[model samples]
Target: MSTNVLPLSKPVPADSSLRLVPDVPDFVVGPGLSPEVADVVTLIGGSATAGRNLAETRRIFTQVRRALGPTVPDIASIREEVINTPAGKLNLRLYRPSFGFRPLPALLFFHGGGWTVGDLDSHDTLCRQLAIATGHVIVAVDYRLAPENPWPAPIEDGWEALRWLSNYAPLLAIDPLAIGVAGDSAGGNIAAVLALKARDEGGPALKGQVLIYPCTDLSASLPSHFAHADGYLLTRKQYLAYVANYLAGQDVEQDWRVSPLRAARFDGLPPTVIITAGFDPLLDEGRAYAGRLAAAGVPVIHRSYADMVHGFITMGGRLPAANRAIADIGRALASHDIYAFSDGGGI
Candidate 1:
């Protein structure tokens, strides 16, 4: 990592006094946020009901489905399938775009639940939106979560699935050249690891890697982790709880399987796009990772929604910025320059 740190240049937005509903997590428009994005902040923040943290997080995810229903696309086709990873068979939900994929692009996405709670169902809408917004076929991976599979299992599952998907791109009517990987939070960790692995191992080449507020480092030292540690939608305590459960007493925090930023090198990883939120704990790490890619001379686009919180990508359809972010993601995925590094024998 470089010695330079990019300090926040502007004054922070969203003082504690923003107007919101008088009860349980009301909506509030704050600094660096527009009205539409505020609606998403209010919706997600107020969705927290009293319960075990995991159950409460699930409730918030459920509330996300109820609140953001308008943005979800009508599924033209859902092909539920599985892949044979070294650990075992893993599930993948394939979303064929509206125009079809007899010869289209493919995005292999992974869901985020801090490596513990999410599944195909929790992220179905997000995948559908990507499919509809980008006009590409999407394969949502159901890699085993931590506490159940742990460490290398999720990483291995993601890698194997992407490999097979790339190899069978023709069968799925996808252009192998246009294939990419995506994920949020823990899933982002997996996607990033897969990118590093594929590049280093000489497996299938990828067009891009999309990381949404990813947890790039496991040391818990980033400023976002401390700044938004509590009551900013996802508490640092809750995060540690999730990680503890995810790790299950394993001291694998520094392992590349758990922390992709620790990878020995980044020169050959895919062109990258990383998304972050202003008030989320994992925000700094996402930004830092983008910088790492840039320092390695990889093409990268880093976006920060300063008024938004963690898990904002899934909330895109309801919020205009989120929608715009999704569109931006699609464009990045479909761009022609992702492979520019390999042109003219420069790589």
Candidate 2:
């Protein structure tokens, strides 16, 4: 971390306003935020909900999410393909950072929209930036959404996508043993679940997992949930709404797949990077999950952006901190020995 702290300079857009709640703790206020992040928070106005129906809400959420950041340009190439899965044909966008003769490490990415919204396009720029920064082939999964496909459907899609990537490594020009899973928010939940599933299923061993402000608990009753719930970009109301739509009619609260923090065991999982925003409602749970992973002897790098709010990772173009966070994620991935040959041998 650098000693220099950049101060906010640009004037906030007239439509935006800082929506900090009264009586916030000094810790929550900590250091002043980057000007760009402050501007985004102002635009968000502390709530992301916009419509009465799921469709309208999704539309609004996607629009807001895209508007928060600028699109990154010039990746080596992007390829779109469909993979057959138990749920359906899953759409995937492959981002190649650079052309190379040897197989490269890869990350199977899931985009965040509370599992109710978000698509490959919504996260396209971020994925490309990450791919370029990390020198990894990034595969963005377009999993089915909620209030429709629901809980286990998305989970299954994520696991299936991971399996596909590992099984078809030669065709994709990726190292089967070097594949990892990553996502933000709901997508993070999916990535975490997929890691667990992979461990239990005993195949396609994951090299690592990068979870950005993941929702580890579906109960949504943590102290952080109530403390920083409203003013953060992701509010308690929006959290509840997404979960309601996702788990509607399902009673899998205690199921580890649905709420990973509730899992009885975290042993034998791959090395992990868990990132959490200081003011996110899901902060405590993410931290708790990291502790659990470490206790279970899994190598874990837990990072918390104490002065930032939820979804900061997606605001790289706007927030310098977000760019730094992305670099941190890249460095974490690079530090691991992902190039080690799998027992199955070279492709």
Candidate 3:
């Protein structure tokens, strides 16, 4: 990995799609968020590359969660239970908006913790914001973390969750047709793979898929790995280290679930939205996936946040530009009629 950090001010298109959040206003983020979360985030961000292997990585991440405390969002309803699946029991948290729910679009969310850490608690605010902004039923999937469960475990949980969601629609009060999958970083990898799996297997098709600064490739050869390898929040050394543990001698570089960019066929996938952070280490791969989706004739809309770093979407409620993304997703959902689509009907 290169020691140089790509300056956020580097040349890019002059459109509003490019964003940098720390430069934006402070209102997007609200009060009530504990300061302890900030300190914990810094610790994990710094700990990114310190883990010698998966075991050590899991130990450090467990410590990080202890430091971060728990979810503090008012609207976020944290359900800490295990859902029985064909593969095994998986953990999940379902976040419902303040609005009364008859039936609404459901977004199965995967929290980003490098596939090592992160749970429903860590992503409380983001899920609340998504529920409010998109007016949808957001079910955040708390799949077993890596090194503990590894690649196929997380991937299998994700796919089963989707099937379970479809199979148990009445229990969830979700419009089966209006269902979609979303996540950031490692979660995004799951979302991309889920979208592909549904299309290939003739499973319940998603209305739309949202990927926020997704890590689409695991080979560690993308340019952003070197271009923004240091001092930009997400370091390349930290990235490779996390994957090394999460993968742990598993062959994931070619697995479509681990690296959605490697999927051979992309046609017939749902209309999609791809969000990219300009200074993010995964920028190139995210954009490339969007391009591939477009090339494959999938209706796709791509946005590049020029000034933001990786994980800005999770911070949208705090930064002005991030708030815009929240609203953008809402409007897109409105068009998709996320609440109205049903598998038996049209999604």
Best by TM-score: 2
- The runs of at least 3 residues in candidate 3 whose Cα sits more than 4 Å from the true structure, single-residue gaps closed, are 1-47, 52-73, 76-81, 98-101, 316-318, 335-347
Q: In lDDT terms, which candidate is top? A: 2
TM-score of each model, in listed order = 0.81, 0.87, 0.78
Higher-TM-score candidate of 2 and 3: 2
Consecutive 10-residue window with the lowest summed lDDT within model 1: 1-10
- Evaluate model 1: give its TM-score: 0.81
Ranking by lDDT: 2, 1, 3
Per-residue alpha-carbon lDDT of candidate 2 for residues 71-103, written as tens digits (9 for 90 to 100) = 555777788778898767998888878776778
Off by over 4 Å in 2: 1-36, 340-347
In the range 150-247, model 1's lDDT, one tens digit per residue, is 77677878888988998887776677777788888888888898888888889788878889889888877888899777656666766887677677
The window of 10 residues in a row where model 2 has the poorest summed lDDT is: 1-10
Q: What is the C-alpha lDDT of each candidate?
A: 0.72, 0.78, 0.69
Compute the lDDT for candidate 2.
Answer: 0.78
